[model samples]
Target chain A: MRSNTFKTLLLGAVFLGAGAVAASAGTLDDVKAKGFVQCGVNGAGLAGFGAPDDAGNWKGLDVDACRAVAAAVFGDPSKVKYTGLSAKERFTALQSKEIDMLARNSTNTMSRDTQLGITFTGVNYYDGQGFMVKKALGVSSAKDLNGASVCVQSGTTTELNLADYFKSNGMTFNAVVFEKQEEADAAYDAGRCDAYTTDASGLYSIRLKMTNPDDSIVLPEIISKEPLGPAVRQGDDQWESIVRWSHYAMLIAEEFGVTQANVDEMKSSENPEVQRLLGVGEGVDFGTPIGLTKDWAYNIIKGVGNYGESFERNVGEGSPLKIARGLNALWTKGGLQYAPPIR
Target chain B: MTLRDKTADETPRSWVRAVLYDATIRGWVFQGLVLLALILFAVWVVHNTAANLRAANIPFGFDFLNMRAGFDISQKPIDYTLDSSHAQAFKVGLLNTIIVSVLGIILATIIGFVVGISRLSRNWLLARAATVYIETLRNVPLLLQLLFWYKAVLSVLPGPRQGYVLPFSANLSNRGLTMPRPIPGEGFEIVMWSVPVAVALAWAIARWAKNRQAATGQSFPVFRASLGIVVGLPVVLFVVLGAPLSFEIPELKGFNFAGGMVVHPELIAMLLGISLYTATFIAETVRAGILAVSTGQSEAAFSLGLRPRQTMRLIVVPQAMRVIIPPLTSQYLNLTKNSSLALAIGYPDLVAVFAGSTLNITGHAIEVIAITMAVYLALSLITAALMNWFNARVALVER
Candidate 1:
């Protein structure tokens, strides 16, 4: 009688464990069944980062990141919908499953990763706190901003960084803060502040919106490290791997000198690395474990272009933003991007 | 059936019928049913919120209040740093909200009373002008007014490079209005303490003068005497203490002012928006209250040899106040609640700092929002209680 009851309890425990596994295993299948991936993008039109075009089609580096993930999963970059979100609403929207993933320009931090029920895939952009001042101000360095009034957007880490930078340097400054990024931009344009502070990428974005873009100059100092990346809800490891590898596929494609124009030609190359990345090797099915097509990385490169191509097209020298690849280069090229071998 | 002998064998109504027809029992039954429904609904909401939070793995707790608020509040009314706890940040926000609302209330009352009386003035242009002001101000949305003030009006001002210099060595720029801040010297504290004592002495002397007038039919210049004691005593004390005060004038050092008090543009914009918007409603209340008082009281005072000012002061004002206080108290509450709009302009009010930035940072929405609502509710109740007390003091005491 005692043995029988113990067996029954063991059976109950097994069922509960299976139920927990089943609950988290469906996010990938759910996205596929829904026929489109829902991606959260910045709503306030950060120029080269995430903004909708005149035809209402989303465009930018962040938007392209979402499209690349969709391409990897569904073999079609267009199988994605964009939801514009503000800084305050992005994480909650992700946690609530209101969106499948967030590709907005969000900085990955320790607390957010562990506490907010979200996982950072990888750094899509290496950003840092920087200041932009009117060229006429003749302030060459951030340290020269002593006693200057700076306009900043409230509810962001940039505010804390600004305070720390100034305080550590033994200088005092004033912050003229606003709720919206556009408000801060407009205030800066109207000369309500001596400098406007945000991420370096954001400084470039705002400069494009300025009345006289040439009249302003971004300062040289980077006060804080902001590793902006994509994030997804933290429960399903399958979904996280899919998002993480989608970005890695692009990075590996860039390292192999593959572009959208040459991906078809590279498919026939004898290089083992290229063949494996394109999923054309014996007993090679890297995508099936992640519940994606075998040619997932190939589809991403073909449909969304490689990482270097996306960067140049959206925010780098090929685009109007003209931002150089400072620290975003590959590990082989003296930068931080290093992806694991596809084999 | 109509007379008396038709129902000799009639029995009492059934218990169900009797109870249904009983007003007191019916009332209690319905009330209990409603109370049960409300309780169930509240429980369902709390349960659903907890379930959702658990499913999302978002921890629901107030431990976030102890976390470091890694942000800077530019307009903090108290000492705060980036290392400050979220609880201290909340206190700073609450203090700012109180300061702006109290200042807005005082300014709105003065403007409202002036505009209200002018609307009832005998001069045609003055009345019409006041009427136009009320219509325009009341009809416009307060948010739009705030945006207009912050963006269009203040932002368009010249930069600090060409700050508009004003008299008394003050400066006005898009940053703010910068002026001299007064610093109290050695004996200024003593002089400050004397003013309150002078006010109390003045009150006692006024009471004595009133009693003397009533008992001996002798007139005394009570108003002048009280005014002299209140104003003159402070001045004499200051002079006797060798005028222990100094002014620190603001100077244009770098990008903005230094060495003085700075009234930020956000504060000015919110103050202007809230006061101007609320004054129109208060003006209408005042006008209606004054109009509700019968004109006969005014004529009766005049016939009793009272001047126009005396009739207004002694007879009309007291009755008008009884009608005004209730709605006026609500107006004060509305103004306080409306000050939350300071968030839109980054005024660092309670809602902006605590409910907004803190909630966003910590991700504990339910707790933060509940605390904010409770604070506003408590403030409204306290204001209502105080106003009710003042209302009772002015109420008619009939023999």
Candidate 2:
């Protein structure tokens, strides 16, 4: 079974390799013809990130990003089919055209951006590698975990960062790796290791699944920068622009205070930037250039809401994860999330 | 004219007739055509793969093995770190696979033989229990059994601080089973050296005993003497060398046991799962083999004044072994291959380390997976070769 599964995956990769080089030229047309945008997402439940609910609906920041693209393309947020993939399968799924866009909580690394034949549209969630330890361990900082055993998901940036951080600090530690997030969580919960390391946002998400959530505490140190986002196959500039602008539209919507409820009311505002954003007296037909309707941004805002609203609803104070906005806040609010002017 | 000319004249047959009616020509033509088709198919797959890899910008080379793995593996048989080369990580994974499959093969064979005999036993409850074991375990999938053992059984064990103590100063917990590690001290080499010498001496004694029995019609207790010498020699060497082996007992540490031999729960769970699962099939093979032996042979031996145990061992077993061997060889190979399932439970087997985590990190999926498949093929071939040799040795000698 193992060999057969591996052979099938290898064969899929081979067939994808040939098709990817040809590069699906009319990806936007293909999505339209299919009547739904196939979006890749994290199959495992990472709370506030992409995860399925009891009713099998995908909900989170990344899911909202996929929905935003759907709204821009079809003018309906529900016009999407989500393909749940692991970190290892995400890129291949995108390259193979098994998925139109990948909105999984995947980091936008340089190698992935250039080498994997895919382009990350924009940073959906800025995260960093961090450690979550038992409170009784009394380890407040990552530096204190000198000889500790760390439970980590293999095949992730978190594993590499954990190794680098410990080596640079001259600490020898043991790493207990698991293939999946749930396995790692089970190991950590069963006390197989001293600490569990992943993205800080992931730590909070995982903590909610723990038997004793209050007994765990995330360490203060952030070891590595992880700007995770949605990605699409490269070489399709039209589709890339649409996916890229879907995120930019959300950010711009947030900048203009275009809440989903008031987006229609704000359509008649006197503000030039807001008017231009809504495609109402625009200097350039931004929507036409990106191959979408004039009210594409407005449609996105109405369907999936702005960046701040999605963040609040998914990972912020409005959700159970309750993660602070931190670096994900708008530039005016002293954060790194800055979108270009709509004009 | 056709029959007369074919026999009398040395004329070449027509291409169509030769290919259609000629046995030698027809077989070669068919084989050649099939080979050509196979080659064409292989070429197509390769061309597609190469083009795809080039398009994906993922270089199709094995140079990635030289790069650092940048990941941690828990069960390190040899010294390995995150800084180790991908090649080294592969070696660690291969070693772990060998360790589990080898241990699993030995344990499964023992269990299989015992259970197989019990199934044929006259004792009603024992036979029923053996039958139940064979039926239940063989029917379920191996992967589910591995998960049941790892998650349902091993994962439910208490943590390190509240570990379950076992006999012989061992401890069991979610972390693993920690036992005493025998560290070889000064003069330990002498005891190792004495083992081969003891075996040689035992062989000579056994040969001499067989000769004495043939000559005097009185058998010597050669087995007892050989056993004593083989075991006693190692003990005498150890004592003379001032008992040069110290036990490194596992002590409870911050989060786990420290300074001892730790059999990872992953390994234990995988070993148990694979061995138990394979043993069921092996038991059926043994039972069928034993049943194949004619009862008349056993009765004949008993009529010759041989005891029931002797009749079974000397008459029935030798005949039954021939039937049992070929299928048993396949079961052993299956167990070795199934050990790759350890990847699912995070046991860091060859597939997990190489095709899985290493491939994910390096993005050299094709090369890593190819290597992993090749390794399993090689492992299976080697096992088959060994088992075939054993089968040959145990087969009845013909004049």
Candidate 3:
């Protein structure tokens, strides 16, 4: 009787799952037909990435990436719809086909790609784990964190990195854990912990929210590599290419000096590389490869400018984050943001 | 007449006869068809998943669990490092979940009982206050409450440099509550062993006293005598062992408390939120259970010259428990399940660590999700089984 019941239930589950799979064609086909991308973003208040303004307008580095993809495909950046997701809901939303892409400051790792059934296109920001301590502690480096209370967000790479750093150094530190970065920041600021640790980019964003930013200093140490990038659902090869090339086009456009302001004029430039990037004179057939327009790169550059321009305006030297390019600079400038040749 | 009877004795068609003559066989055939369809469907899904994973160039395996978890865990009960295996990370996460769930259960029960009793209070103000608490808390979503606690309450606390001093060498700050940690000295192990031994001795004494009272009609003062032995024996052992215990008081260092156990604010907030939210529901359950035991039972006990305390303890509570156990079991399960909200505050619970981070790190969504679901299901089943056993013991036996 038990075996029979189990078999019946198994049959029901199989039919349900199969029905769901069969009803939904590939996500790639659906995305192309829609003509605009649906991107998920961090709804939390991470300043440089996805925080809202006082007027309630969403703007950030991650947000710009989504807009750039929209520009590349639809010729209008505003055509994209941004669905805000909390950290926990972000992946599931993408997996459920609620969003076409996730442009949050998500770290690219092997486990997420293969296990979670997602694919990270390429790294846009190279970050590292670091610690921030109050000035009164007189601590300059992570080495001085002996027996210190460290406030760390739980369920993050920072948490494990913190344990490793302390244990490896043979130091015993108390952990004042929080579930969210904002809570950890609050605790750190309120003297709940001697220090706060997270990704360096996050540290900067969090530090800006401190009441006395001058009283805290981020240690000049990078622990773990956090290669944050945009990702798409797995099995969507065409959509993946479109997103990947969209980001790469931004890089190539920056390399060729195709600023948003000069994009129209740059189309008729004498330089072959500039002309090719702006969709002039037998431009590389990006439209054919990714099932978009040949001028997809042109729309991207014209709408959001190139990578350098986006960085400076959103989170670089000009922004409140005031972060240096570091590894995010162009490959020719001895950084890691290298784009494949457009050919 | 014999020839006619012989002609009429011919059997029906074989297939018709099989269906008509055997109910079990018919049932088996029907069930078999359903099973075959299910197997075919499963094969198709497996095939699609394989194809999808292959196309994406992603390997599907559990080998990732053996790899080093390069991240740090802030509130690990056991020793953990970034170099620890992913399985170790998961264990740490599970331990954190258990810690929060246990604490939340105790707190919720206390609050629940108080509110439950207050709801029945004769005083108008007290009843209204209890009603307000239940209505307000039970209505709001738990996730929002957790976020509010973390973001609004705990975050607004004073920093470590300006820590709030509580009684008995404890500090409350945004960092968390810091308390004096007990450090074991030499010969402390012997003193620790005395605690359980003393309790066991007390239990034996109580049993003996109860039997004597029943047989000889003599009161032995079991409560007072057992209490003395349980309390005194441990203290005597500690003193005899030359006070082999010390406390490491939490001191304010340059900017924060050091040299003591630090509770993380995430844990504090999550615990507070879960306990407070679940308490309201538990309060309603307790009230309903108590009310389910008719007022006549308590009145009967009172008329027999029993004190109010005895009436409640001996008569009402036992009967009320029959009404309470099932729902109480569900409340406990709810608390355990709600511990998954630890993800909101980054508590690294089982779901957050294994299902979230590990799944992300390993890309084994199917396996990770299945494991997570199975763990929760097992926990719920175990809780239900225990409650069922308790209910059976307390249930009235009808001849």
TM-score for each model: 0.89, 0.94, 0.82
Interface root mean square deviation for model 2, in Å?
2.8
Residues B288-326, candidate 2: write the lDDT tens digits.
999998889988998999999878888898888999999
Candidate 3: true contacts recovered, fraction? 0.32
lDDT by residue for model 1 (A1-343), tens: 1121233233223322322232254678889899999999987888777899889888888888899889998999999999887675677667766689998888888878887778999999999999999999889999999998888876677877888899899888887766668777887888878899999999988998899999999999999999999999887889999999999999999999988999999988799889989988777679998888889999999998998899898898988889988898888988888899998
Give the candidate number with the greatest lDDT: 2
Residue by residue across A263-313, what tens digits does model 3's lDDT show?
Answer: 898888998776666667753564766667778889998888899998998
lDDT of 2 at A72: 92
Query: What DockQ does predicted model 1 obtain?
Result: 0.24
TM-score evaluated only on chain B, model 3: 0.87
Ranking by DockQ: 2, 3, 1
Question: Taking the tens digit of each residue's C-alpha lDDT, what string does model 3 give over B128-238?
Answer: 999999999999999888878877655577777676889979888776788999999999988878888988998998899889988997868778888898889878988
- For each of the candidates, give the backbone clash count: 0, 2, 28
Which residue pairs collide, candidate 2? Answer: A17-B52, A18-B52
lDDT at residue B163 of model 2 (Cα atoms): 86
Highest-TM-score candidate: 2
lDDT of 2 at B44: 79
Clashing pairs in 1: none
Provide the lowest-lDDT 10-residue window in model 3 chain A.
A1-10
